[model samples]
Target: MIQITNLHKSYKTGSNSLHVLKGINFSVKEGELVSIMGSSGSGKSTLLNILGMLDEADTGSYVLDGVTIKNLNEKQAARYRNKFLGFIFQSFNLISYKSALDNVALPLYYQGMARGERMDRAMAYLEKVGLADWSGHLPNQLSGGQKQRVAIARALASDPKVLLADEPTGALDTKTSYEVMDLIQQINDEGRTILVVTHENDIAHMTKRIVNLKDGLIIEDTPVQQVRALENV
Candidate 1:
């Protein structure tokens, strides 16, 4: 669950300031799949970064699963991030030399988990993502969709409370994107709160709710009939 109110953020460029988010307010409940939709420069990325605790808001309040998020030291922020959030990026962020299994296991490795337990958890998630058979394959060895699946597995391996995906299917073909979205929908059905930041209409429609952002503010936030990606595929 997430609650944000009156969020405001800006960046300074020499003598001018670029305002990224303005008076943003929203809440996402548990078991909900939501998409933040916006064009480039609409502040969706800024909002996602703030939500992921990768960046700080200039002003406002953010509450994640009952914990207030504000003014924390780097160490404290990192601890909360590891304990509560997981991320999936469009770029697939995997190490070129690491096998799929090793890539999935990296987060657990950061948590100081032992090799045996880490491998066990990693394999379980890889299997969950239907990538168990490809565990030994490296990123370059896999296709775009396959790499994204591996990224999804890696994000879930840590068992975080919320999954944050930014342009999750941006780099894939339409068919592959549908497949990836189907997996995301299935994961949401199992009751994990998922927030996707995307500009594609079809991608946003796959989610239960869509929050449309324009010029750094939410213009529309509404629930809609969930679009099944498999049907579209």
Candidate 2:
């Protein structure tokens, strides 16, 4: 589970102070799929980055799975992030030259797992995301949907407790978007908590909960009925 309170983050541009996050307070329970919806400049991505431990907030507190990130040093933050968080991006951040299997195995490699074990785990996750047949294919050889699936597999490769995805379906067509969303839902059903930031309402509806952000504050938080996972197809 993750808890954040009075979380404030700001940036300095020349002589102006840009307040991106203003006292964000929210909690994400274990195994819950939560969607964060916001418009441009709503600070959703900033909040996600802070939650992902890639950016530090200037004030307030963030407790992820019981550890306070406000006090962690750079190395400590890196270690904790590697251990507890997985990320999916709209761009499908994959190494163009690496095969899908190798792309998934990259995280495990960073975790220092043995090559054999890492390869095994990567292959398993690839199958889980319906990319087993494309394991040997390069990113360019795959379709947009396949690339996103590989990204999802890479995110799951680390076996993190939480998966944070940003605009996951932004680059794909409607059908492919639905497919990617379905795959993410399946992962959530398997008990991995997911917090996704998306501008698409339909995509947000797939999640069990919705949190809306505006002007750096949480304007609305509501829980919807649990929808059928991977049944949207």
**Model 1 bad stretches (over 4 Å):** none
lDDT (10s digit) by residue, model 1, range 1-233: 89999999999999999999999999999999999999999999999999999999999999999999999899998999999999999999999999999999999998999999999999999999999999999999999999999999999989899999999999999999999999999999999999999889999999999999999999999999999999998
Q: Per-residue lDDT for 117-187 in model 2, tens only?
A: 99999999999888899899999999999999999989998989899999999999987888888888888
TM-score of 2: 0.96
Q: Which window of ten consecutive residues has the lowest lDDT sum in model 1?
A: 72-81
TM-score of 1: 0.99
Candidate 2's C-alpha lDDT?
0.91
- As for candidate 1, its clashing pairs are none
